[model samples]
Target: MTITIDTTRCIGCGMCAYAAPQVFRVVGKYSTVISQPEGRRDPKVSNAENGCPVNAISVTR
Candidate 1:
């Protein structure tokens, strides 16, 4: 899986981090990818992408 965050659209609400702490983090008013998972098998990653209020998170496999 590939994860990407559009910083311009990110609101820093931390929902991505809250949903997938291992993959995302809120930093300086934007959500960022902290680590890349091997694939989309991790459910939290999907939750993070879906939970982002601003649709800043993107996951592609």
Candidate 2:
């Protein structure tokens, strides 16, 4: 799986970090990926992508 965040579209709401602490964190004024999931899929990652209010996160397999 691959995860990417469009920084231009991100609002720095920290929802992604809130949804997946192990995979994401709030840095400065943006949410950034801390680590990728070892598995092909992660529910927390999906939740983070979906929870992003500005739709800045993208996940692909």
Candidate 3:
């Protein structure tokens, strides 16, 4: 699976970054993709997606 952020929906909240610093982060006013976290699958990314207040993050296979 892959983790992607809908920049339009991102509010620079940085919740995902705070939840999983190694996998997600905010760059300026938008959510940015850091590196895919190790030893995990779609579920791991989905957790990050769920943490975004704006629902900006998406996990897809």
Q: Lowest lDDT 10-mer window, candidate 2?
A: 31-40
| RMSD vs true structure, all candidates | 0.9, 0.7, 2.1
lDDT tens digits, residue span 25-51, model 2 = 889888889898887799989999988
Clashing pairs in 3: none
- Tens-digit lDDT track for model 3 on 1-61? 5778888888998778777777787788987988865555745466678777888887765
Model number with the top TM-score: 2
Better of 1 and 2 by lDDT: 2
> What is the C-alpha lDDT profile of model 1 across 3-47, one tens digit per residue?
999988999999888888998888898988999999446899988
Candidate 1 structure, TM-score to reference: 0.92
Which candidate wins on lDDT? 2
Q: How well does each candidate superpose onto the true structure, as a TM-score?
A: 0.92, 0.94, 0.79
TM-score of 2: 0.94
**Any runs in candidate 3 off by more than 4 Å, and if so which?**
42-44
**How high is the lDDT of residue 2 in model 3?**
72
lDDT, each prediction: 0.87, 0.90, 0.77
Scored against the true structure, residue 38 in model 2 reaches a CA lDDT of 81
How would the candidate models be sorted by lDDT, starting from the highest?
2, 1, 3
Q: Which stretches of candidate 1 lie above 4 Å from their native place?
A: none
